[model samples]
Target: EVTGDERYKDYWRFLHDGGMRPYIQRILDHSNATRGYRIDRLEALAADGIPAILETRTYPKIGAWEQAHEGKPWYTRSGRLEFYRDEPEFRDSGENIVVHREPIDSTFYEPNVIVADPRHPLLRPRRPEDYGADPRDVGGDARQARHVVLTVDQMLSSRHPLAEDGYRHVFHTPKYRHGAHTTAVDTDIVAIWFGPFGDIYREDPRIPFINEMYLDINPLDARELGIEDGDYVYIDADPHDRPFRGWRDNPEWYRVARLMARARYYPGTPRGITRMWHNMYGATWGSVRGSRENPTGLAKSPTTNYQSLFRTGSHQSCTRGWLKPTWMTDTLTVKGLMGQKITRGFVPDVHCPTGAPRESLVRISHAENGGFGGERLWRPARLGVRPTYESERLQKFIAGRFVRRG
Candidate 1:
């Protein structure tokens, strides 16, 4: 739509109409493949004959695979593995040499904080006096290594908006076991084992068959906050760009800008870290409180909304996207297969425009009404009904696959 090219509307139809073959042929034409070895048609991609790109019948490995078999050079400027980078962007960023750098916002330092390790031969002090140490002190080694610390000035900076607010826990969203990335976890079968509450409303038609998002907190952290297992809690993060900010005053939205989730005490989790599945659904027009004309109270959807199964809010409520400067570089560089080098601008995920969402710090507290006390509970008539043959079979399958008989 932005390009106003109608042919680009239906990508599948465009490909079937021979719009993509030209691009494929262009790559093949530029490849080091001999004219006779290159496939003339796109159908040859699935043909029995081996394609020019495939060096062997076995799986192809990246790096040196082509260099060892064919005489093609590596994709780097020097055509060999090198530790030092001479790019101006690298020099400006102080990342000319590969080094360990802490996370942007997750760490105490501001975004892109660089620190030198005292253990490194080049960074070690020649004498104890060089680092303001007592020259009279005798030690086995010079302990002049500097560590990253949260300073009063850094806390007051706008970049560390939540630093002074005492939001200590690091919030992270990881993939769900039952889902493929963000997909499939919402289904009834997958939901049975996905969340703290599991699929308790599976048989209720009024309620969707899905699990509510929950926060996995270490037992020590939960105890300190007076949060017990299965207790409803509100997770609040940096308010600069928090979720549902516009609906803060809306009476219909409960605890706007804060994520409501059940707190699960997990001893395996670290004290300062919290985990939530990344597959939970987000709020939609149908899930939002109130009608198009007037809005009031939660779960007052005019239409059927499965996202309401998410209960209060999504995991994203405590997180925001962070863009890296190195990822935004427009420098033309050589990339692609060894034989098919393409000099182009930054390619997302490959080089540029990467979104980092795990840098958020959050604080969790018990909700005003703990547990599901004030919420409208779904107790369908089928709850006490006798199980049918189909239900029995499904129960048996679930037991065999997920639950232990003992």
Candidate 2:
């Protein structure tokens, strides 16, 4: 759809010729105008904002920090980058230096072994001398000068099980804006990032029903479960009992927020993978088909499957807890906001130093009954109902026996 790079020759654009430095300067200038006013007047304080921003967010490889601390050594004990840190955690972990290790959850095709490269790929600095990655520091274990084993490794080794069902696929929850100008899922607004269309989707008849929820399965996997494309299926996970802040989800790993969605066959999906797009069809809104055959009720305010009782309303219902991925911590010292480490947080909401809602091992079965309705419960109680006419003779007999026809 892109006609040409210079389509709007005069208007600003991120083209091939321009570099990030200029683009960033423009953003810094704008921020200094609007954002810098809180500390002091923008006119007075704006001139100094660019240097502050560069030293903070942008590439600091050769920025103001280099000049500010010209003689002072960096944070390391050696005043240089140390591949083998003298921390007990590093020595204990066996990772004194860098080593190539596989992902914790990787289904083992080969033995889970790692090859250590203690020497620098580019600069082979000698050990006890120059302090580049020393080969002796590469191999880790107790008694060996190798890398320290990490606490994260032990945490990863403790396998967390979700579902016992024979078939649990590698699950990913993808972000599909059922429509634009929405919150977690779809809403009544047809919004672009900026401009007049921000509230436009409210009246547009062409918007698809956004509340209906569905899980994407590979075509080959669909056939194995006897699930045809568009068939309803009940998706669930194993019990997980942990404390979730109760803002978006709950604490239990196995606690299931059950809802039903049609099984959609996604093209090019490999056999052992599944995906569910967020917030679409459910019991309330999108599922209701208009009564008129010809169809004219298009302009009405849009409604998705609202009021999902089990929280199965969105794909994140199954995503719970955390998995620590990376090693070490990044200390970001900020000013004015009381030295807020923007990347780090004490709680889950502000920052989850863990991974986001990505992969899950889940169980899927055919939802034969109409989803979210009491179809099965209502059927079982049908035998208890008796007609009043049939019970009239019994009522009279009981009255005569108890009251003697009074």
TM-score to native of every candidate shown? 0.60, 0.41
- On lDDT, the leading prediction is 1
- Candidate 2 residue spans exceeding 4 A from truth: 1-164, 176-186, 189-210, 242-256, 278-313, 323-352, 369-406
Q: Write the per-residue lDDT of candidate 2 for residues 1-406, one digit (tens) a residue.
A: 2667666753545545664445554555566233332322433556866423323433534544643566644433344545654344334333445655433222211111233443434323222223344533221111122222223344345332332334356657665543332343333332222111122332322222322345778867866886655555766543232112342353232233354555666656777778765433322233223211115322122354232312232455445533331233232211122222233323343323455444445567876532123132112113322122124555566567545654
Give the TM-score (vs. native) of candidate 2: 0.41
| Residue-pair clashes per candidate | 1, 25
User: Best candidate per TM-score, number?
Assistant: 1
Report lDDT (CA) for all predictions.
Answer: 0.55, 0.40
Q: Candidate 1: lDDT of 207? A: 25
| Superposed model 1: Cα runs more than 4 Å off | 1-74, 108-111, 117-161, 184-186, 202-209, 244-257, 290-309, 332-339, 368-406
